[model samples]
Target: MTVIRINAITVPADSGDELAHRFAARAGAVDGADGFEGFELLKPTDGRDQWLVVTRWRDDAAFQAWLDSPAFAHGHRSESERGGGEAQRPVSSHSEVWSYEIAGGSPA
Candidate 1:
């Protein structure tokens, strides 16, 4: 079955925008990675500086491969180098599921 990974992060109020932008750039660069299905970054309108990253993959193996890839490592390193004031200490959670349904979509 396909797998989905959802991660929520709470950034410091001051660093939220910068970190979100950096994460978007990194995600865009790896959009075509093998077995990558799709990704979403969400920012809530409420007061908290929270962000969410959701990714879909062909399977657990594919997800693991991406995690082990140089692209993933490089992206993480680049983000770390940016030194977002609260990027390192964000409240976070990750959830994974083995199956899901995509209601609709067209070839991009």
Candidate 2:
């Protein structure tokens, strides 16, 4: 079954743009991964600080494989970890991953 992972990143009121910019910088990084289906970055429109990163995979195994891969680590590394002079501050203050599957839904 298809699996969905929603990374809810809560940033400060003024840091939404930076979060989106960072995601844009690494666009398509996961496109070639095995069983990777699609992704979306959702910005809040109701004065909320939480942004949503939604990714779809063919199954849990596929998602877990990506999580254990080098690409995942590289994509999530801080600037200092990637050999930059200094570590850039994180945009989100808090975040959590929510998992789900197609319980019931109409066809896309």
Per-model C-alpha RMSD: 5.0, 1.5
lDDT (Cα atoms) of all candidates against the true structure: 0.69, 0.91
Model 2 accuracy (lDDT, Cα): 0.91
Clashing pairs in 2: none
**Which numbered prediction scores highest in TM-score against the true structure?**
2
What C-alpha lDDT, on a 0 to 100 scale, does residue 34 get in candidate 2?
A: 99
Worst 10 residues of 1 by lDDT: 90-99
Per-model TM-score on C-alpha atoms: 0.66, 0.92
Q: Count the backbone clashes (under 3 Å) in each candidate.
A: 0, 0
Report the lDDT tens digits of candidate 2 across residue range 1-108.
899999999989889888888888788899999999999999999988899999999999999999999999888876466776666888888999999998997889
Off by over 4 Å in 1: 79-108
Q: Write the per-residue lDDT of candidate 1 for residues 48-68, one digit (tens) a residue.
A: 666767788888788889888
